[model samples]
Every structure is written in structure tokens, then in C-alpha cells.
Target: MSKLDIKQLTKQIIDGVGGEENIVSAAHCSTRLRIVLKDDSLIETDIVAEIDGVKGSFNNGGQFQIILGTGLVNQVYQEFLVQTDLSEVGKEELKEIASSKLNIAQRILKALADVFVPILPALVASGLLMGLNNLLTAEGLFVSGETVIGAYPQFADLAEMINIFANTAFVFLPILIGFYAAKIFGGTPVLGAVIGAIMIHPDLLNGYSYGQAVLDNTVPVWNVFGFEIAKVGYQGTVLPVIGAAFVLAKTEKVLRKFIPMMLDNIITPLLAVLFTASFTFIAIGPVMRVVGDWMTNGVMWLFFELGPIGGAIYGVVYPLLVITGMHHSLVTSEMQILANIETLGGSPTFAVVAASNVAQGAAALAVFYLFKKDVKMKAIASAAGISALLGITEPAVFGVNLKLKYPFVAALIGSAAGAAYATWREVLSVSQGPAGLPGVIVIRPQSMVQYMVALGIAFVVTFVVTILFAKMSQGKSKLN
Candidate 1:
């Protein structure tokens, strides 16, 4: 309701948090000022929360978060930066600092997230279009055509064009992975792109359908430096490409050290690409792929052996994993399912993920309704709930449910129940997309209704349970 001095507000927040000495790192996302504190006990929570323009404050995921609205948060964060020496602290650095506090497993999971998260937008967009194409060309939707004209008598060209859009991302997925992975590893992105291009060159056999060639004993192999190398392209691969990128980055760094400044442009990139590509194909690609398959099968074995109970546990753990930034590690499993539906069956992981996502939104919605008197919190909850339903749960998880504590537990219970029901029904998703309400777009057509039922279960159960929790807590459990 009132404009206040940002400098004053920044000073208050820093001083309240025991000054810059107490803060390990600081970063901001959309609607919160996220800070990692060296000592939580030293934080003057009440003082910081009482600051004007501050909406709410809480700690989760190893970060002390202040819920300032988007525009205000950025401004305060900038002023806070100016007042302190944390100006150079970027999001990645802060993430690393936060992740350092986690155990080895969590650190590995976070590393997995770091690799996959940046690439998710490409995956989501392409997956959505592909799903729509499948739906449009389904048996009852479009008649099968024997010839080009017969296939699309009216919209043949349009259909062909749309198919290209749907297929491009997946077709060039390795290139995308290379570009992003190289950037993440601090290498020249163009070198990674070149390496990716080499992997999928026209001379190479298609990796996706190479099994038939293997069965027929016709798969191509190349003799290089007395080593036999597979000539299969990496189309939908995950680990091999990422591993290759890391290798390329390290190799380039080593090259940079010895190569003179003037000769760098020609020698550095050439040597880097040449060595890295050879090393990747000769060793890294084959080895990481086997490791990736092992990880995928391990997860699938647990899912099938445990059946519905496994799905329930997966659903419960996923949201908590999200808070710790570990759930994205499961992408390797989902990628396997997406690429090998015939062998692996469709993805049960999606059914559980959808359940978890909807439950998060439901929990946030309940908090919104229960905290009707706390206008700022109610506003935050409403925004977060909407975000979660759209398949982005960070706002809902960090800004609302986890902040409130009890609601997060209630959501976990609801998620487990809903996931068990979905697993029993054998609901499956064919591709990646936003989970929760939007998940219906990517689920198998035959199982779409069942998936919807699972979502409804998650939402209703979480909402009801959270309401009860809020009522019992009597407003005392809220974060200020």
C-alpha cells in the first residue's frame, strides 16, 4: 500500500539476517528473495518479516526465502547487492552453494537437474506438439492414406509441415543437449554443436532403430586407431551426449592452457572437437549408454516389482525430491520409457509425477482458502496454486506449501494415494509435458480418463487433508 526506501529495506533485511557475514549466497526467483545463511539460529526472523514491503518469509531447500512480489523482490535484491559484496553471486553459484549442504545422493541428483533442467523447454515444446500430432492422426481422428494425395487430400502440405515442427526437436535432440551442456560446462557451444552433428552424420546408422541392424548382424562399425567403433547416431540419447560435452569442455580447457593466443581460433577448437569426438565415440558414448540402460532398468525393475506400492512411494518422494532439487534425475528413466515404449511399456512415472504435481497445487489452494485473513499469504497461495496446476510447482512448493510446513506433508499423503490408484489402472504418458491438469495432453489416449481420475483424487485428497491440518494448527504453524 505504500512505497518505501529500498536501501532502508535492504539494510533491515541484511542486518536482521546477521549481516553479510551470515549469508552464504543469495539468489532470487520470480517472487522470492532466496538466501543461504551460514547460521539459521542467528537470523532475526521477526525483524525481517516485519519489514515494510515484505510479504512473507520462510526457510526451505536450504534457503531462507523472503516472499516479496516479483518486481519488488528484484529491486530489493539489487539494492541488497549494492549494499554488500555479493554482487557477483549468480544463480548457478548460489545453487552450488545450496547443493553443497546436501548429501552425496542429493548432490548427484542436483547435478542431474542442472544438466536436464535447461533442456526441458525444448523437450516440453516438442513433446506437446508430437502428442497433438499423435492425437490428430489416431484411428478415429484421421483416416489412413495409402498415397501422398490420399493421406491429406485437403491439408497434405499443412500436415507435412506440422510433422516437421513436431519432429525437429527430437530429431536434433543431441545437438540441443550438446549446445546446452557445453554452455553449462563452460566450453565453446559451437564445438559441442559440431560434435553433436558428427554423432548424427548421414553416414551413421540411426541409433533409435539400430536394434534391427544389430539383430540382422548388419550394424556398421568403423576401424579407427586399431579400435572398432560403432557407427550409430545418438538421436534421443541423454547421458552419452552430456558425458561427451563434459569431456569436450575439459579437453578445450586443457588445450587453452597450451595453445598460444593467436593460434587458439584454429588449433583449440579443431583439436578439442577431434579428440573429444573420438574419445566419446570410442569410449564415453558406449560406456555411458550401458550405464544409462542399467539405471533405467534398475528403476523399472523396482516399479514393476513393487507395482502400485512403488508408484505410491515414487509419488510421495518426488515432491520432497523437488524441494531438494533431485527429482529431475529421474528424467533418464522417463527418456528410456519415451523412446522404448514397445519394450518397456509406457511411462508409469508420468502418472505418479502428475499426481504429485496436482497434489502440490491442491495443497497450495487449501492454504489460500484457509489463510483468507492473511491477505498477502492468500495472494501468494493463489498464484502458486495456479502455477502448480500449469506444471510449474516451484512457486507453490517454496512459496506456499513448504513454507506452511504441514501442507507439504498433507500433499505427500494425497500424492501417494493418487499414484497408487493410477499405477493400478496402468495409466501411462507417452511424452514429456507439464504435469497435473495439463498432463492430460501427453497421457496415452486410452488411459487419459484414468489419469484425470488420478489427478482429481490427488487434488481433492490434498485439499481436504490440508484444510484439516490448517484447522488443527490454529494458525500457529504458519511461517511469518
Candidate 2:
């Protein structure tokens, strides 16, 4: 590919998309130049596609997006800003403009993404560590004849020590979720952290073990204001913490408005915490627990009742969820599955998701081979495909597959095929990993082969289907 002249490319992009006046806002993700247009009709789609260095273009979630390779997109975005009226605007301002154009459901999904993306790194690390611990303990993997820690009783203590590190994060997951949730909701993060601590105080019953107590009718409750408040901690819970943080933030704002400014410093936080915490314990916490349980049972029912068919449906829709940014909302369900792995004998959800990611990458790889003549396009597709294989799919989906609509559909079909086979084989993942090819790290020893087969099917099926469809489209375009 020729070296990108940022100035020239940026000018072509701006002029082809109807100049600066036509743009409401502009931003770039890993490999796409995302813009919100004031009037969609003003965009010259053919002209934009023909611009030098532009790979493909599409409209999604009210944004007019243009695919450009990762490094080049940022340089083009910077140059585009300088040459246009957007130079003075911050990225956040552009995001706000784009968000203002979304519908109610889309706005909620965006909010969930904002809350979860910041905390994903920590969860990702803890999850990988859990998988590593499982691998080390798996029979015959890291041992001469048997499991490393299981056969040598002397090494048990050392194994337990390592387990502590793996368990700490998930054991206190609510605290982490609360801190991030509060920040997202415009509340004091420290205060939300304190609420998380309160919920998990040593005196309270551990939430993870609460189900047995519930079955035995031995669960503890605190009586306050003639109401019985469950004393179960919110360790692995997600919905309650998020709901609490949101309520706390709104309550604080209301208190600030009514409370005298002179006494604000002393009274506001104290009352905010007291009232919010009380209300949460009394109402919100219990209500959210019911909702969380419903979602958990719903997924459990789907998998157990319908088996492979359920997995097929989940796989087909998951990529579409990722596209709309709604996948973050399902993290709570994933966590619940992980927490109850013993009862479920392992969740097929993670394996299905991993297969979907592989399918997406495979579809992008097919597009990469199709555009072999265009060096810039091939390079972008290859890099995006590799990123997807490594467990990141935004670049592959938005930058390649979705730009050429057929590839995205091909990926979904491939994902469904893989997921059904995986579920039929009952492939199990012990914990979440970075996903995609690296997801092998989380598969149970006995299920590893099945997982690999699922992934291979997803990749091969998507690649062949996408290549055939793209070739057909090429012929149609020539005829036109």
C-alpha cells in the first residue's frame, strides 16, 4: 500500500461525505471513522467508497461509518479535525452528539457499555487467572502422572495460595461493579464502594451460599421498620449493585437541591448514604435479586430444556448483540453461570460466544483474501481478522464484515452451526478467558477437543460461505 498522506485523504473524505457542514459529529474506533451526519442523503456513498485508502462504508446505529486501517484512521481523524470545524471539539462532545441521535433502547445499551468497558480489563485478568489455575490443576496437564496439586498432597497448600489470588476478584465483584456503576451514574465512587462493603460485611451471610439456606428455610433477615431485609451479601451479584449506585446518585442530587447550601458539606453525603443504603436494603436490593435470578434461570432453562437448539439461537444473536453494544448487559448472566458451574456442570455460554468470535474473524479473513489486489484493504482486513481471533471483534465486525453486509450474515450462520455442535457435545468452559482462539485456556481438560472442533467448524464454514457470497456480489456489481 502507498503511504497515507493524511491531509489529502482527510480532504477527500470530508468532500466526499458532503463537507464539514454535513457532519453532526465524528469519532473513530479502532479501524473505522464513525460520523453522525446531519442529513444522510447528502452523503455520496459511491464517491466515499472510491476515496483513496477507504476500504468500505456503511450506516449503523445512526452513524455513517467508513472503514480505514487502525493507525491510518487515527491520523486521518486528526487531520480531518484540523481541516474542518471539528478541531475545537473534544471526542466526548462528538460522542454526545452521536448519542443524542440514538433511540431509547440504543441509549441504554450505550450506557451499559460505558459502565462495563472501563472495568473489563480487571475482570479479564481475574478470569484468565482462574482459567490458569484450572489448567494447572487439571489431571495430567502439569503433572507427571496426575494433577499437579491433587497427587502431591504436599503441594496442596501452595495451590491454595494461588487460588486465593484467583478468587479475590470474583469474591468481591460487587464492590468493583459498584465503584464503576456509581462513577457512570454521576455518584461518588467511594460512597458506592462503601455500600458494596456494607453488603458483604463479615457478619452478613455470603450471597454465593444463600441458595442452600433458602432451600432449607434457614436464611437470616434483619427486621427494620416492620420490613424483613435479607442479610445475604451481594458478592457475585451485578444488577443490585448497579441499581443501588443509580438510586444513590439520583438521591444525592435530589438531596443537594433541597438541603441548604450552608449545611451541604455536612448533611448531603451522610443523608445520601443513610437514605440510599436503607432504601436499597429495604426495596431495591430484593427487587433486583429477583430480576437477576429470573435472568439466570431463564438462560439455564434455555440451555437445559432445548439443548443444542438453544445454543444455536444464542450464537446467532450474540454477534448482533455485540454490534448494538447490548452484549455488556449479558455479563451478569455469564457471571451467574460461572458462579454455579458446579451445579450446571459448566456453562456452554462462554464456548458458544468464543465460537461466534471465531466465525466473525473467519468472515473478515475471507474478505481480506477477496480484496488481495487492494493492499490497503487487505492489510486492514487481515489485522482486523487477527484481532477478532484474539478475542476482540469490534474491528473485524465494524471495519470489515458489517461494511460488506453479506460477511456479517455469513458469520452469524457459521456461529449457529458451531454453537449447535458444541452444545450437542456438551463442551464446557470452567471460566471466561479473553475469548476466541485464546479461549482454549478456559476449557475443561476433557472438553478441550470438542471446543477446538467447534471453533474449527465456525472458521471453515464462515470462510467458504463469505468467499462465495463476495464473489457473487462482485459479478453483480460488474453487470450493473
Candidate 3:
């Protein structure tokens, strides 16, 4: 869209939202302009939808979002700020406003999002490194049932080095989770890290070998007041550290309130560490560990036991989860899966995500051609389609597919089929990355070909279904 067009559309949107006075705060993601309105009833949804550049609009998390697609959103948002004379206070304030409107459950999920969002970079890089190492060491690259390490013995040390680099994140995952969770729960970040370190102390037996230790009858324990507490390291566990962080943060806060300022710094840290560690090792750690195991077993049942049927169900509901913003919780689940990548074989969830994402992209691509006569829609669909293929789907979803009912349904069908096939084939990613075609880099060496084939099936299915649906709806005219 042109500069003039953006400015004009911004004006119309402002008027539709009952002007600058009604808008409390504003933020923009890749595809939509998110605005917090002081008076919810003041905004005119029909008027906003009528605007030329708007692909779609909705109310989510107490924010009114107007979809304008990739590059165009930033332009319109800038123009919006200019027209309204609104300060660039940004997303933080919007988050606060949104939080106040959320229920207890939503707030809890938001906390999880906050704690995990910053950790993605480290995890993503590690995953990619691991993927590369897997490729380097995998068998059958040149000959059937022959290993790469055998072919190139000189690179073995380098591959082993890469493996160590990749394992660092998962090995010390609790420290990362604790520090962030502490920050989120309003505690000392360092204290959280300290508690995390305590959980994985060298003297303690590793959690990964807990089963083996039990089988061998070598599980170590500390007897305290007639109670036996196991000393198992939570190396790759998530929930235990999070619970420990919360306890640590709360303990520090309470201690500070009661203890005098003169002795506060020294006594507070001392008591906080000792108490948090004792409680964590004794109560919180064991309890959360059991809960975490339940979660692990649940996911294993869905993604492994049910296999293709599970994949289909997940694919079908994935889009719905995205719409509700509940998908953020899945990051924690993926972490658990990826943490035990050695044991789990592969991440079926990532494969399902890729299928779902690419299916949406394909649906958008079909729309781009279908609406070629309309310049604004064609631009929106084309940009959204490409963006979705790159692993970001909000643009394609809200901007094109979701707005057009048929394409969304088509994408769902494609996603289900692809996920089922991929799961059945046992396709899995080595790392967390984009779900688009470009995401192939993260696929494990053995599954790269299978992943590509699955995604190709998804693309074809979505495109064909969209075209057929659109043609069927041509006379009925209920697309939007």
C-alpha cells in the first residue's frame, strides 16, 4: 500500500474506533494493529471492516486487532500514530492493560509465555546446532546402513564438540527456567538461578538415569526428621524449577518484609536460599516431578501411542488453539519433548506444527490467485502467503485464510492430512524453528526427505481444496 493510502486508511480506522480519545494504547505485531480501547462499545466493528486495507478485524485478549498483512501493518500503524498523535509507549503497556482484563487462567498462561519467550533464541540455536551434528553423524548418507562418522573419522571429534555445545541448553535448562520464572514471579533472578543449581548439584544422581538408578537400587536419599528425600538431579525438567522459583521468590519477599533492614541483606539471602532449597528438594521437587511426568506421559500418549490419529487430532485443533492464544503453553511441552530428544526419537509436535503452518500458507497462496482482480486483497494474500511459508502464520491466518471461511477450512483439512502422514512416517524435527518449507533445516538427518514430502502433500491438499471450495462458493458468495 502507498503512503497516502496508509494515511487515509489510518484516518478511517481512527474514526471507526471513536477517535484517539477512545484508544488507550496501541501495539502492532507482524500482521495486525492491536489497540486497547477505553470504551469497548465506542468502536464500530462494521465501519472498521469496511476500510479498504483491512483484511479482517477481531477482539482478542481485550485488544481490538485489525489485520493489514506484513509490511503494510507497520506502515498503517505508523500512520495511525501520526494521525492520533499517540506516543510510542508500545507493547509493554498494552500487555499490562491486557493482563488486567484476563481471568486467573489466562494470567497464568500469560506468565508462562513471559517466562519462555526470552529463552527461545538459545533453544532455537541449540536445536539447529544439534540438527547439524545429527546430519554430520547420521548413517546411510552415501551407502545403506553405513555411518558418516565411519566414513569421516577425522570429523568425529568436531561432531562430538558440536554435541556438547548443543547439549548445554538442555543440561542446564532449569537454571534458565528458574532465572526467568523468578523474574516473572517477582523474585531475585540470581536466587532463582541458585535454586536451579542446587537441583542439579554434582553430588546428586541425574534425573535422566533415575529409572536406571531405581532398577539398580542405587537411589540416594537424605533422611530428615524420619523422612527420606531423594537427591535426584532435575537436569532437563521444567516444572520443578518453575515451582521452586515461585517458592524462592515468595520466601525472599516475605523475609524482607519481616526482617530488619540492617540484617536484611545478609539474613534474607541466607534464609531464602536455605528454605527454598530444603522445601524444593523435600516437597516441591518431588511433587512437581510427578506432575511433570504425568504431562510427559500425556504428550507421549497423544503423539506416540495414538500416532497418526493423534497427529490428525492435534492438526485439527492447532488452529483453534492459535486463535485462543493457548498455543504458547505448547512451548513448555515442546521443551519437555526436545529435552528428552535422545529418548523420544523425534518431535511429532514440531512436524504437526510445520504441516499446520504450511497448510495455512498454501491456503493463502490459493487466495492470492483467486482474488487477483482485487489489488488490495491480492497484495494482502500474496504477502500473507509468503510470510506463512516462512513460519509466521498470523498474517496468512488473520489477513487471508480466517477472513475467508473456505480457505481456513481447506487449511485445516490439509494440516490434518499432512500431520497424520508425517506422524505415521515418524517424521520429527531436530530443533525448534519455523514450520514453513524453510524449516526443513531443523529436520533430523534421517527424516529430512520424509518431512519435505509431508509438507508437499499439505501444500497440494490445501491449494486444491481452497480452489474447489472457492469455486463452489462462487454463486453462494459466503467466502468472507
Native-vs-model 3 lDDT?
0.86
lDDT of 2 by residue, 132-247 (tens): 66666778776766887777788777767767776677677778777888887888898888777777788888877888999999889988779788888775577888889888
Reference-based lDDT, each prediction: 0.79, 0.80, 0.86
Enumerate clash totals for all models, in the order shown.
0, 0, 0
Check candidate 1 and list the clashing pairs: none
Runs with alpha carbons beyond 4 Å of true place in candidate 2: 1-5, 39-46, 57-64, 88-93, 140-145, 339-347, 370-380, 430-432, 468-480
Q: Candidate 2: deviation at residue 14, Å? A: 2.0
The candidate with the higher lDDT, 2 or 3, is 3
Please write out the lDDT profile of model 1 over residues 322-432, one tens digit for every residue: 765667678766775565653554678988988998899999999999887988778878988887887878778876787678999999999998998898888887668
Model number with the top lDDT: 3
Model 1 lDDT at residue 257: 96
1 or 2, greater by lDDT: 2
Give a tens-digit lDDT track for model 3, residues 1-480. 677887889999999998888987788987789998887789887788779978777776778888876788888888888888877756767888877777788787788878888888898888898987887877887656867777878988999999999889878888999899999999999989989988999899988999899899999998988999898998768888989999999999999999999998799989999999999988998898888888778877987899999998999899888888888777777777787888876677888899999999999999999987888778778877887888888778877787778999999999999999998998987668878888888888788898998889888999999999999998677655
Q: Which candidate is the best by TM-score?
A: 3
As for TM-score, the candidate ahead, 1 or 2, is 2
